[model samples]
Target: MMPSPGAAQPPSRGKARRGRPPAPISPGTGPSHRAWLEPVRSELFTSGLTLDDLVDRSGYSKTRISELLRGNGYYPAWELTFSVTRALGLPTPPLRRLWTAAAREAHKGPDWIRHCIEQVAHETEGPPLAYRAFCETLHQPYLQYARAFLLTDPRARGVVAETFDILWLSWNEAAASPDIRRYAWRLLRSRVMLRAARHQDGSPDLRAAVFSTDEAHAVQDPGHFMALTELIDLFEAITRLPDDQMDVAVLHYLCGFPDHQISHVLGLTPALTRAVDHHARATVETLLNAPNTQE
Candidate 1:
Protein backbone atom coordinates (compact mmCIF):
# COMPACT_ATOMS: atom_id res chain seq x y z
CA MET A 1 0.00 0.00 0.00
CA MET A 2 1.16 3.57 -0.82
CA PRO A 3 1.95 5.80 2.10
CA SER A 4 -0.10 8.99 2.49
CA PRO A 5 1.82 12.19 1.66
CA GLY A 6 2.27 13.19 5.28
CA ALA A 7 2.44 9.64 6.65
CA ALA A 8 5.56 7.56 6.98
CA GLN A 9 5.56 4.22 5.12
CA PRO A 10 6.18 1.05 7.10
CA PRO A 11 9.43 -0.83 6.29
CA SER A 12 8.92 -4.21 4.59
CA ARG A 13 9.56 -7.13 7.00
CA GLY A 14 11.54 -9.05 4.31
CA LYS A 15 13.97 -6.13 3.79
CA ALA A 16 14.38 -5.68 7.56
CA ARG A 17 15.09 -9.41 8.06
CA ARG A 18 17.62 -9.46 5.13
CA GLY A 19 20.17 -7.61 7.32
CA ARG A 20 19.96 -4.54 5.08
CA PRO A 21 17.71 -1.56 5.81
CA PRO A 22 16.42 1.10 3.42
CA ALA A 23 18.68 4.06 2.82
CA PRO A 24 18.38 6.89 5.30
CA ILE A 25 16.02 9.66 4.22
CA SER A 26 17.58 13.00 3.25
CA PRO A 27 16.60 16.24 5.08
CA GLY A 28 14.17 17.31 2.38
CA THR A 29 12.89 13.80 1.60
CA GLY A 30 9.77 13.92 3.79
CA PRO A 31 6.61 15.97 4.40
CA SER A 32 8.37 19.13 5.56
CA HIS A 33 9.40 20.59 2.18
CA ARG A 34 6.03 22.08 1.26
CA ALA A 35 5.49 22.93 4.93
CA TRP A 36 8.34 25.40 4.57
CA LEU A 37 7.99 26.69 0.99
CA GLU A 38 4.23 27.32 1.07
CA PRO A 39 4.22 29.74 3.98
CA VAL A 40 7.04 31.79 2.54
CA ARG A 41 5.34 31.97 -0.83
CA SER A 42 2.07 32.97 0.84
CA GLU A 43 3.84 35.66 2.81
CA LEU A 44 5.37 37.10 -0.33
CA PHE A 45 2.05 37.00 -2.13
CA THR A 46 0.28 38.63 0.83
CA SER A 47 2.94 41.32 0.98
CA GLY A 48 2.01 42.39 -2.54
CA LEU A 49 5.33 41.21 -3.82
CA THR A 50 6.36 38.69 -6.43
CA LEU A 51 9.53 36.82 -7.29
CA ASP A 52 10.14 39.53 -9.88
CA ASP A 53 9.90 42.13 -7.13
CA LEU A 54 12.52 40.27 -5.13
CA VAL A 55 14.72 40.16 -8.24
CA ASP A 56 14.33 43.90 -8.72
CA ARG A 57 15.07 44.65 -5.08
CA SER A 58 17.94 42.19 -4.77
CA GLY A 59 19.47 42.89 -8.20
CA TYR A 60 19.16 39.21 -9.04
CA SER A 61 18.09 37.71 -12.34
CA LYS A 62 14.52 36.65 -13.06
CA THR A 63 15.66 33.23 -14.23
CA ARG A 64 17.39 32.62 -10.90
CA ILE A 65 14.19 33.33 -9.01
CA SER A 66 12.18 31.12 -11.37
CA GLU A 67 14.60 28.26 -10.80
CA LEU A 68 14.31 28.64 -7.04
CA LEU A 69 10.50 28.65 -7.29
CA ARG A 70 10.51 25.50 -9.38
CA GLY A 71 12.90 23.73 -6.94
CA ASN A 72 15.17 22.97 -9.87
CA GLY A 73 18.14 25.27 -9.27
CA TYR A 74 20.42 26.39 -6.48
CA TYR A 75 18.44 27.72 -3.54
CA PRO A 76 19.21 31.30 -2.65
CA ALA A 77 22.67 31.52 -1.17
CA TRP A 78 22.81 32.87 2.38
CA GLU A 79 23.86 36.33 1.22
CA LEU A 80 21.11 36.49 -1.37
CA THR A 81 18.52 35.26 1.11
CA PHE A 82 19.63 37.83 3.69
CA SER A 83 19.36 40.63 1.16
CA VAL A 84 15.92 39.53 0.03
CA THR A 85 14.71 39.18 3.62
CA ARG A 86 15.93 42.65 4.59
CA ALA A 87 14.46 44.28 1.50
CA LEU A 88 11.05 42.76 2.23
CA GLY A 89 11.38 43.00 6.04
CA LEU A 90 10.24 39.38 6.29
CA PRO A 91 11.12 36.83 8.96
CA THR A 92 13.91 34.57 7.65
CA PRO A 93 14.13 31.60 9.95
CA PRO A 94 11.32 29.59 8.35
CA LEU A 95 12.44 30.18 4.79
CA ARG A 96 16.03 29.50 5.72
CA ARG A 97 15.17 26.14 7.29
CA LEU A 98 13.07 25.14 4.29
CA TRP A 99 15.82 26.00 1.85
CA THR A 100 18.36 24.07 3.89
CA ALA A 101 16.16 21.03 3.81
CA ALA A 102 15.40 21.38 0.10
CA ALA A 103 19.15 21.48 -0.59
CA ARG A 104 19.56 18.17 1.22
CA GLU A 105 16.79 16.59 -0.86
CA ALA A 106 18.18 17.88 -4.19
CA HIS A 107 19.52 14.48 -5.34
CA LYS A 108 17.01 12.31 -3.50
CA GLY A 109 14.54 10.20 -5.50
CA PRO A 110 10.85 10.53 -6.45
CA ASP A 111 9.31 10.06 -2.98
CA TRP A 112 10.92 13.31 -1.79
CA ILE A 113 9.60 15.24 -4.75
CA ARG A 114 6.11 13.84 -4.28
CA HIS A 115 6.16 14.75 -0.57
CA CYS A 116 7.27 18.33 -1.40
CA ILE A 117 4.45 18.74 -3.89
CA GLU A 118 1.86 17.59 -1.36
CA GLN A 119 3.19 20.04 1.19
CA VAL A 120 2.93 22.85 -1.32
CA ALA A 121 -0.70 22.01 -2.05
CA HIS A 122 -1.55 21.99 1.63
CA GLU A 123 0.22 25.25 2.29
CA THR A 124 -1.51 27.06 -0.55
CA GLU A 125 -4.90 26.08 0.79
CA GLY A 126 -4.73 28.34 3.85
CA PRO A 127 -7.21 28.50 6.71
CA PRO A 128 -10.02 30.97 6.10
CA LEU A 129 -10.72 31.74 9.76
CA ALA A 130 -7.05 32.34 10.43
CA TYR A 131 -6.86 34.68 7.45
CA ARG A 132 -9.91 36.64 8.59
CA ALA A 133 -8.37 37.02 12.03
CA PHE A 134 -5.12 38.24 10.55
CA CYS A 135 -6.90 40.84 8.43
CA GLU A 136 -8.84 42.19 11.40
CA THR A 137 -5.64 42.58 13.37
CA LEU A 138 -4.00 44.55 10.59
CA HIS A 139 -6.97 46.81 9.86
CA GLN A 140 -8.41 47.67 13.27
CA PRO A 141 -6.01 50.53 13.96
CA TYR A 142 -6.39 52.01 10.50
CA LEU A 143 -10.15 51.80 10.77
CA GLN A 144 -10.14 53.72 14.05
CA TYR A 145 -8.06 56.49 12.52
CA ALA A 146 -10.32 56.65 9.49
CA ARG A 147 -13.33 57.00 11.73
CA ALA A 148 -11.73 59.93 13.50
CA PHE A 149 -10.80 61.62 10.23
CA LEU A 150 -14.32 61.18 8.89
CA LEU A 151 -15.96 62.69 11.97
CA THR A 152 -14.65 66.12 10.96
CA ASP A 153 -16.26 65.91 7.55
CA PRO A 154 -19.78 64.53 7.45
CA ARG A 155 -19.73 65.05 3.71
CA ALA A 156 -17.01 62.47 3.54
CA ARG A 157 -18.62 60.00 5.93
CA GLY A 158 -20.14 57.75 3.31
CA VAL A 159 -17.13 57.90 1.05
CA VAL A 160 -14.77 57.14 3.89
CA ALA A 161 -16.84 54.10 4.91
CA GLU A 162 -16.86 52.90 1.33
CA THR A 163 -13.14 53.32 1.09
CA PHE A 164 -12.62 51.31 4.29
CA ASP A 165 -14.95 48.64 2.97
CA ILE A 166 -12.92 48.35 -0.19
CA LEU A 167 -9.71 48.35 1.75
CA TRP A 168 -10.93 45.57 4.02
CA LEU A 169 -12.21 43.53 1.11
CA SER A 170 -8.96 43.83 -0.77
CA TRP A 171 -6.97 43.02 2.35
CA ASN A 172 -8.99 39.84 2.92
CA GLU A 173 -8.47 38.74 -0.66
CA ALA A 174 -4.73 39.23 -0.35
CA ALA A 175 -4.09 40.20 3.29
CA ALA A 176 -2.89 43.73 2.48
CA SER A 177 -0.50 42.17 0.05
CA PRO A 178 2.07 44.77 -1.02
CA ASP A 179 0.61 45.09 -4.52
CA ILE A 180 -2.89 45.63 -3.18
CA ARG A 181 -1.63 48.18 -0.69
CA ARG A 182 0.06 50.03 -3.53
CA TYR A 183 -3.12 49.99 -5.58
CA ALA A 184 -5.22 51.00 -2.55
CA TRP A 185 -2.95 53.94 -1.84
CA ARG A 186 -3.49 55.19 -5.38
CA LEU A 187 -7.25 54.87 -5.04
CA LEU A 188 -7.12 56.57 -1.67
CA ARG A 189 -5.07 59.47 -3.05
CA SER A 190 -7.55 59.91 -5.85
CA ARG A 191 -10.49 59.83 -3.45
CA VAL A 192 -8.83 62.42 -1.23
CA MET A 193 -8.22 64.65 -4.23
CA LEU A 194 -11.77 64.26 -5.50
CA ARG A 195 -13.23 65.00 -2.07
CA ALA A 196 -10.96 68.00 -1.65
CA ALA A 197 -12.02 69.35 -5.03
CA ARG A 198 -15.70 68.90 -4.31
CA HIS A 199 -15.58 70.52 -0.91
CA GLN A 200 -12.67 72.85 -1.37
CA ASP A 201 -14.65 75.96 -0.54
CA GLY A 202 -16.43 74.51 2.45
CA SER A 203 -13.49 72.73 4.13
CA PRO A 204 -13.03 75.47 6.72
CA ASP A 205 -16.61 75.22 7.91
CA LEU A 206 -16.39 71.44 7.81
CA ARG A 207 -13.77 71.52 10.57
CA ALA A 208 -16.18 73.44 12.73
CA ALA A 209 -18.87 70.87 11.99
CA VAL A 210 -16.94 68.12 13.85
CA PHE A 211 -17.30 69.69 17.28
CA SER A 212 -20.75 69.37 18.71
CA THR A 213 -22.29 72.53 20.19
CA ASP A 214 -21.97 70.99 23.66
CA GLU A 215 -18.29 70.03 23.15
CA ALA A 216 -17.44 73.34 21.55
CA HIS A 217 -19.22 75.23 24.28
CA ALA A 218 -17.74 73.24 27.16
CA VAL A 219 -14.07 73.59 26.28
CA GLN A 220 -12.31 75.34 29.18
CA ASP A 221 -8.68 74.28 28.53
CA PRO A 222 -7.33 77.09 26.41
CA GLY A 223 -4.14 75.22 25.42
CA HIS A 224 -6.06 72.12 24.28
CA PHE A 225 -8.51 74.19 22.29
CA MET A 226 -5.67 76.20 20.68
CA ALA A 227 -3.84 73.04 19.68
CA LEU A 228 -6.95 71.64 18.05
CA THR A 229 -7.52 74.90 16.27
CA GLU A 230 -3.91 74.98 15.09
CA LEU A 231 -4.17 71.47 13.66
CA ILE A 232 -7.26 72.42 11.72
CA ASP A 233 -5.50 75.50 10.43
CA LEU A 234 -2.49 73.40 9.38
CA PHE A 235 -4.73 71.08 7.37
CA GLU A 236 -6.32 74.08 5.68
CA ALA A 237 -2.93 75.45 4.70
CA ILE A 238 -1.92 72.04 3.30
CA THR A 239 -4.98 72.07 1.07
CA ARG A 240 -3.83 75.37 -0.48
CA LEU A 241 -0.72 73.84 -2.09
CA PRO A 242 -0.73 72.58 -5.69
CA ASP A 243 -1.99 69.06 -6.31
CA ASP A 244 1.37 67.34 -6.81
CA GLN A 245 3.06 68.91 -3.82
CA MET A 246 0.02 68.36 -1.65
CA ASP A 247 -0.17 64.73 -2.69
CA VAL A 248 3.43 63.98 -1.76
CA ALA A 249 3.02 65.68 1.59
CA VAL A 250 -0.28 64.04 2.43
CA LEU A 251 1.01 60.64 1.44
CA HIS A 252 4.13 61.12 3.50
CA TYR A 253 2.26 62.32 6.59
CA LEU A 254 -1.22 60.81 6.43
CA CYS A 255 -0.63 57.51 4.68
CA GLY A 256 2.94 57.07 5.92
CA PHE A 257 4.41 56.10 2.57
CA PRO A 258 8.17 56.45 2.39
CA ASP A 259 9.76 58.43 -0.43
CA HIS A 260 10.82 55.37 -2.46
CA GLN A 261 7.37 53.78 -2.26
CA ILE A 262 5.82 57.13 -3.05
CA SER A 263 8.00 57.36 -6.15
CA HIS A 264 6.79 53.97 -7.32
CA VAL A 265 3.14 54.88 -6.67
CA LEU A 266 3.45 58.32 -8.23
CA GLY A 267 5.69 57.21 -11.13
CA LEU A 268 8.29 59.84 -10.21
CA THR A 269 12.01 59.33 -10.26
CA PRO A 270 13.89 59.71 -6.97
CA ALA A 271 15.20 63.15 -7.93
CA LEU A 272 11.71 64.41 -8.76
CA THR A 273 10.31 62.95 -5.53
CA ARG A 274 12.90 64.85 -3.48
CA ALA A 275 12.16 68.04 -5.36
CA VAL A 276 8.43 67.79 -4.76
CA ASP A 277 8.92 66.96 -1.11
CA HIS A 278 11.25 69.89 -0.64
CA HIS A 279 8.85 72.33 -2.30
CA ALA A 280 5.91 71.06 -0.29
CA ARG A 281 7.86 71.36 2.98
CA ALA A 282 8.85 74.94 2.18
CA THR A 283 5.29 75.89 1.31
CA VAL A 284 3.93 74.43 4.52
CA GLU A 285 6.63 76.17 6.55
CA THR A 286 5.73 79.48 5.02
CA LEU A 287 2.04 78.97 5.74
CA LEU A 288 2.77 77.92 9.36
CA ASN A 289 4.76 81.12 9.94
CA ALA A 290 2.05 83.30 8.45
CA PRO A 291 -0.30 82.71 11.40
CA ASN A 292 2.34 83.75 13.99
CA THR A 293 3.07 86.96 12.08
CA GLN A 294 -0.65 87.82 12.01
CA GLU A 295 -0.81 87.28 15.77
Candidate 2:
Protein backbone atom coordinates (compact mmCIF):
# COMPACT_ATOMS: atom_id res chain seq x y z
CA MET A 1 0.00 0.00 0.00
CA MET A 2 1.17 3.54 -0.50
CA PRO A 3 2.50 5.23 2.61
CA SER A 4 0.08 7.33 4.58
CA PRO A 5 0.73 11.08 4.74
CA GLY A 6 -0.59 11.07 8.29
CA ALA A 7 1.60 8.21 9.52
CA ALA A 8 3.77 10.50 11.64
CA GLN A 9 1.36 13.18 12.75
CA PRO A 10 -1.91 13.00 14.63
CA PRO A 11 -5.20 13.72 12.90
CA SER A 12 -5.10 17.22 11.54
CA ARG A 13 -8.27 19.21 11.03
CA GLY A 14 -7.46 18.98 7.37
CA LYS A 15 -8.02 15.26 7.70
CA ALA A 16 -11.75 15.61 8.11
CA ARG A 17 -11.99 17.73 5.00
CA ARG A 18 -9.54 15.53 3.18
CA GLY A 19 -11.66 12.50 3.95
CA ARG A 20 -14.75 14.33 2.83
CA PRO A 21 -15.56 14.65 -0.84
CA PRO A 22 -14.29 17.64 -2.71
CA ALA A 23 -16.70 20.41 -3.56
CA PRO A 24 -18.21 19.47 -6.86
CA ILE A 25 -17.12 21.75 -9.65
CA SER A 26 -19.64 22.24 -12.41
CA PRO A 27 -19.61 19.11 -14.57
CA GLY A 28 -19.24 20.22 -18.17
CA THR A 29 -16.18 22.35 -18.80
CA GLY A 30 -12.42 22.41 -18.23
CA PRO A 31 -10.18 25.07 -16.70
CA SER A 32 -10.32 27.94 -19.18
CA HIS A 33 -7.17 29.97 -19.83
CA ARG A 34 -6.46 33.42 -21.27
CA ALA A 35 -3.40 35.69 -21.32
CA TRP A 36 -2.93 38.91 -19.32
CA LEU A 37 -2.12 42.02 -21.42
CA GLU A 38 -3.00 45.25 -19.64
CA PRO A 39 0.48 46.29 -18.57
CA VAL A 40 1.80 46.06 -22.09
CA ARG A 41 -1.33 47.64 -23.45
CA SER A 42 -1.15 50.52 -20.99
CA GLU A 43 2.53 50.96 -21.70
CA LEU A 44 1.96 50.96 -25.42
CA PHE A 45 -0.37 53.88 -24.93
CA THR A 46 1.81 55.78 -22.46
CA SER A 47 5.35 55.06 -23.66
CA GLY A 48 4.54 55.12 -27.38
CA LEU A 49 6.01 51.63 -27.88
CA THR A 50 4.49 49.98 -30.90
CA LEU A 51 4.41 46.36 -31.99
CA ASP A 52 7.40 47.06 -34.22
CA ASP A 53 9.25 48.58 -31.31
CA LEU A 54 8.79 45.42 -29.19
CA VAL A 55 9.75 43.17 -32.12
CA ASP A 56 13.13 44.84 -32.63
CA ARG A 57 13.83 44.90 -28.89
CA SER A 58 12.57 41.42 -27.92
CA GLY A 59 13.22 39.61 -31.24
CA TYR A 60 9.87 37.82 -31.07
CA SER A 61 7.72 37.94 -34.19
CA LYS A 62 4.90 40.48 -34.24
CA THR A 63 2.45 37.62 -34.41
CA ARG A 64 3.98 36.05 -31.30
CA ILE A 65 3.81 39.28 -29.29
CA SER A 66 0.32 39.94 -30.55
CA GLU A 67 -0.71 36.47 -29.49
CA LEU A 68 0.75 37.14 -26.06
CA LEU A 69 -1.12 40.44 -25.77
CA ARG A 70 -4.46 39.32 -27.15
CA GLY A 71 -4.91 36.35 -24.78
CA ASN A 72 -4.60 34.01 -27.68
CA GLY A 73 -3.09 30.53 -27.76
CA TYR A 74 0.22 29.41 -26.22
CA TYR A 75 1.27 29.92 -22.63
CA PRO A 76 3.94 32.59 -22.40
CA ALA A 77 7.15 30.71 -21.81
CA TRP A 78 9.70 32.34 -19.50
CA GLU A 79 11.49 33.77 -22.51
CA LEU A 80 8.33 35.45 -23.73
CA THR A 81 7.40 36.51 -20.23
CA PHE A 82 10.79 38.14 -19.67
CA SER A 83 10.92 39.60 -23.14
CA VAL A 84 7.66 41.47 -22.73
CA THR A 85 8.45 42.57 -19.20
CA ARG A 86 11.72 44.07 -20.34
CA ALA A 87 10.18 45.49 -23.48
CA LEU A 88 7.72 47.39 -21.36
CA GLY A 89 10.30 48.36 -18.72
CA LEU A 90 7.83 47.15 -16.12
CA PRO A 91 9.18 45.47 -13.01
CA THR A 92 9.23 41.79 -13.88
CA PRO A 93 8.46 40.44 -10.41
CA PRO A 94 4.77 41.35 -10.08
CA LEU A 95 3.93 40.66 -13.70
CA ARG A 96 5.87 37.43 -13.56
CA ARG A 97 4.13 36.41 -10.33
CA LEU A 98 0.70 37.13 -11.67
CA TRP A 99 1.66 35.42 -14.88
CA THR A 100 2.77 32.33 -13.01
CA ALA A 101 -0.31 32.47 -10.86
CA ALA A 102 -2.49 32.38 -13.93
CA ALA A 103 -0.49 29.48 -15.41
CA ARG A 104 -0.76 27.33 -12.29
CA GLU A 105 -4.49 27.77 -12.39
CA ALA A 106 -4.61 26.75 -16.04
CA HIS A 107 -2.44 23.72 -15.43
CA LYS A 108 -5.06 22.36 -13.07
CA GLY A 109 -6.68 19.39 -14.80
CA PRO A 110 -9.47 19.65 -17.31
CA ASP A 111 -12.17 18.48 -14.91
CA TRP A 112 -11.73 21.36 -12.49
CA ILE A 113 -11.57 23.86 -15.29
CA ARG A 114 -14.67 22.40 -16.87
CA HIS A 115 -16.61 22.61 -13.68
CA CYS A 116 -15.56 26.18 -13.07
CA ILE A 117 -16.62 27.13 -16.56
CA GLU A 118 -19.93 25.31 -16.41
CA GLN A 119 -20.78 26.74 -13.03
CA VAL A 120 -20.17 30.26 -14.28
CA ALA A 121 -21.86 29.65 -17.55
CA HIS A 122 -25.03 28.97 -15.58
CA GLU A 123 -24.84 32.21 -13.68
CA THR A 124 -26.75 34.98 -15.37
CA GLU A 125 -24.60 37.87 -14.16
CA GLY A 126 -21.49 36.36 -12.64
CA PRO A 127 -18.08 37.76 -13.40
CA PRO A 128 -16.70 36.87 -16.77
CA LEU A 129 -15.59 33.29 -17.37
CA ALA A 130 -12.00 34.47 -17.18
CA TYR A 131 -12.43 35.85 -13.67
CA ARG A 132 -14.35 32.80 -12.47
CA ALA A 133 -11.46 30.75 -13.74
CA PHE A 134 -9.16 32.78 -11.51
CA CYS A 135 -11.31 32.12 -8.46
CA GLU A 136 -11.40 28.41 -9.16
CA THR A 137 -7.64 28.36 -9.64
CA LEU A 138 -6.93 29.94 -6.26
CA HIS A 139 -9.19 27.49 -4.45
CA GLN A 140 -6.34 26.35 -2.23
CA PRO A 141 -4.05 29.30 -1.78
CA TYR A 142 -5.16 29.51 1.84
CA LEU A 143 -4.52 25.85 2.53
CA GLN A 144 -1.10 26.26 1.00
CA TYR A 145 -0.44 29.22 3.26
CA ALA A 146 -1.65 27.33 6.30
CA ARG A 147 0.49 24.27 5.66
CA ALA A 148 3.73 26.20 5.75
CA PHE A 149 2.92 29.01 8.14
CA LEU A 150 0.41 27.24 10.34
CA LEU A 151 2.80 24.26 10.54
CA THR A 152 0.07 21.68 11.00
CA ASP A 153 -2.69 20.29 8.85
CA PRO A 154 -5.50 20.68 11.36
CA ARG A 155 -4.78 24.34 12.00
CA ALA A 156 -4.35 24.91 8.33
CA ARG A 157 -7.76 23.45 7.75
CA GLY A 158 -9.14 25.62 10.47
CA VAL A 159 -7.67 28.67 8.85
CA VAL A 160 -9.16 27.68 5.55
CA ALA A 161 -12.57 27.29 7.20
CA GLU A 162 -12.38 30.62 8.95
CA THR A 163 -11.25 32.38 5.83
CA PHE A 164 -14.20 30.97 3.98
CA ASP A 165 -16.44 32.06 6.79
CA ILE A 166 -15.20 35.56 6.31
CA LEU A 167 -16.03 35.23 2.67
CA TRP A 168 -19.55 34.02 3.44
CA LEU A 169 -20.18 36.91 5.75
CA SER A 170 -18.85 39.44 3.30
CA TRP A 171 -20.84 38.34 0.29
CA ASN A 172 -22.33 41.81 -0.11
CA GLU A 173 -18.93 43.40 -0.11
CA ALA A 174 -17.66 40.75 -2.49
CA ALA A 175 -20.62 41.21 -4.81
CA ALA A 176 -19.94 44.92 -4.88
CA SER A 177 -16.20 44.53 -5.31
CA PRO A 178 -14.94 45.49 -8.75
CA ASP A 179 -12.18 42.90 -8.68
CA ILE A 180 -13.52 39.88 -6.85
CA ARG A 181 -10.54 37.62 -7.38
CA ARG A 182 -8.01 40.05 -5.94
CA TYR A 183 -10.45 41.05 -3.27
CA ALA A 184 -10.81 37.44 -2.18
CA TRP A 185 -7.04 36.85 -2.33
CA ARG A 186 -6.38 39.78 -0.04
CA LEU A 187 -9.06 38.70 2.40
CA LEU A 188 -7.58 35.25 2.54
CA ARG A 189 -4.03 36.53 2.94
CA SER A 190 -4.99 39.05 5.58
CA ARG A 191 -6.72 36.40 7.61
CA VAL A 192 -3.78 34.08 7.13
CA MET A 193 -1.35 36.79 8.22
CA LEU A 194 -3.40 37.62 11.28
CA ARG A 195 -3.56 33.98 12.25
CA ALA A 196 0.16 33.58 11.66
CA ALA A 197 0.81 36.42 14.09
CA ARG A 198 -1.42 34.89 16.75
CA HIS A 199 0.01 31.40 16.35
CA GLN A 200 3.65 32.26 16.72
CA ASP A 201 5.11 29.54 18.88
CA GLY A 202 8.36 31.33 19.66
CA SER A 203 9.91 29.92 16.52
CA PRO A 204 11.06 32.40 13.95
CA ASP A 205 8.03 33.08 11.81
CA LEU A 206 8.62 32.87 8.11
CA ARG A 207 6.32 34.49 5.55
CA ALA A 208 5.83 32.94 2.10
CA ALA A 209 3.92 35.49 0.05
CA VAL A 210 5.43 36.57 -3.31
CA PHE A 211 3.34 39.67 -3.71
CA SER A 212 1.94 41.35 -0.63
CA THR A 213 -1.70 42.38 -0.47
CA ASP A 214 -0.77 45.92 -1.38
CA GLU A 215 1.59 45.05 -4.18
CA ALA A 216 -0.34 42.44 -6.11
CA HIS A 217 -3.71 43.03 -7.71
CA ALA A 218 -6.72 41.47 -5.99
CA VAL A 219 -7.91 39.78 -9.17
CA GLN A 220 -5.05 38.66 -11.34
CA ASP A 221 -4.86 40.01 -14.86
CA PRO A 222 -6.27 37.40 -17.26
CA GLY A 223 -3.13 35.67 -18.61
CA HIS A 224 -1.51 32.25 -19.04
CA PHE A 225 -4.13 30.85 -21.37
CA MET A 226 -2.06 28.08 -23.01
CA ALA A 227 -3.78 26.26 -25.83
CA LEU A 228 -3.22 22.50 -25.45
CA THR A 229 -2.81 22.13 -29.19
CA GLU A 230 0.47 23.95 -28.62
CA LEU A 231 1.74 21.74 -25.81
CA ILE A 232 5.37 20.84 -26.52
CA ASP A 233 8.51 19.45 -24.91
CA LEU A 234 8.75 21.97 -22.10
CA PHE A 235 5.16 21.17 -21.25
CA GLU A 236 5.85 17.44 -21.11
CA ALA A 237 9.10 18.00 -19.25
CA ILE A 238 7.29 20.02 -16.63
CA THR A 239 5.26 16.94 -15.73
CA ARG A 240 8.48 15.00 -15.11
CA LEU A 241 9.61 17.28 -12.32
CA PRO A 242 9.81 15.92 -8.77
CA ASP A 243 6.70 16.83 -6.84
CA ASP A 244 8.41 19.48 -4.74
CA GLN A 245 10.18 21.08 -7.64
CA MET A 246 7.11 20.87 -9.77
CA ASP A 247 4.97 22.52 -7.11
CA VAL A 248 7.50 25.27 -6.63
CA ALA A 249 7.93 25.79 -10.33
CA VAL A 250 4.19 25.72 -10.87
CA LEU A 251 3.52 28.29 -8.18
CA HIS A 252 6.50 30.39 -9.17
CA TYR A 253 6.08 30.33 -12.92
CA LEU A 254 2.47 29.29 -13.31
CA CYS A 255 0.87 30.51 -10.09
CA GLY A 256 3.19 33.48 -9.41
CA PHE A 257 4.00 32.30 -5.90
CA PRO A 258 7.28 33.68 -4.59
CA ASP A 259 9.94 31.59 -2.92
CA HIS A 260 8.74 32.31 0.58
CA GLN A 261 5.26 30.89 0.03
CA ILE A 262 6.54 27.96 -2.00
CA SER A 263 9.08 27.21 0.73
CA HIS A 264 6.42 27.26 3.40
CA VAL A 265 4.45 24.47 1.71
CA LEU A 266 7.60 22.41 1.13
CA GLY A 267 9.10 23.13 4.56
CA LEU A 268 12.29 24.54 3.08
CA THR A 269 14.16 27.76 3.48
CA PRO A 270 13.28 30.58 1.11
CA ALA A 271 16.70 30.40 -0.49
CA LEU A 272 16.40 26.67 -1.06
CA THR A 273 12.93 27.10 -2.55
CA ARG A 274 14.33 29.57 -5.05
CA ALA A 275 17.15 27.17 -5.82
CA VAL A 276 14.77 24.28 -6.48
CA ASP A 277 12.68 26.48 -8.77
CA HIS A 278 15.81 27.47 -10.66
CA HIS A 279 16.86 23.85 -10.90
CA ALA A 280 13.46 22.72 -12.10
CA ARG A 281 13.34 25.42 -14.75
CA ALA A 282 16.87 24.66 -15.82
CA THR A 283 15.99 21.00 -16.19
CA VAL A 284 12.77 21.67 -18.09
CA GLU A 285 14.44 24.20 -20.35
CA THR A 286 17.19 21.72 -21.09
CA LEU A 287 14.69 18.99 -21.83
CA LEU A 288 12.44 21.34 -23.75
CA ASN A 289 15.22 22.59 -25.98
CA ALA A 290 16.95 19.24 -26.38
CA PRO A 291 16.77 17.76 -29.88
CA ASN A 292 17.20 14.19 -31.11
CA THR A 293 15.48 12.78 -28.01
CA GLN A 294 13.42 10.51 -30.19
CA GLU A 295 14.40 7.23 -28.64
Model 1: how far residue 61 lies from native, Å: 54
By summed lDDT, the worst window of 10 consecutive residues in model 2 runs over 1-10
Write down the TM-score of every candidate. 0.33, 0.28
> What tens digits encode model 2's per-residue C-alpha lDDT throughout 1-295?
1112222121222222222221222232122222234434544444555666566667778787777666566555645655654655554433444454455555755454344333311212233455345445655765765554455678677556544444433444556677555466556555455555331333213323323222233434454223221243333455466655655664565446767765654456778777888899887777666774221
Candidate 1 C-alpha lDDT tens digits along 141-175: 23322333444445355344434433433444445
Cα distance off (Å), candidate 1, residue 25? 68
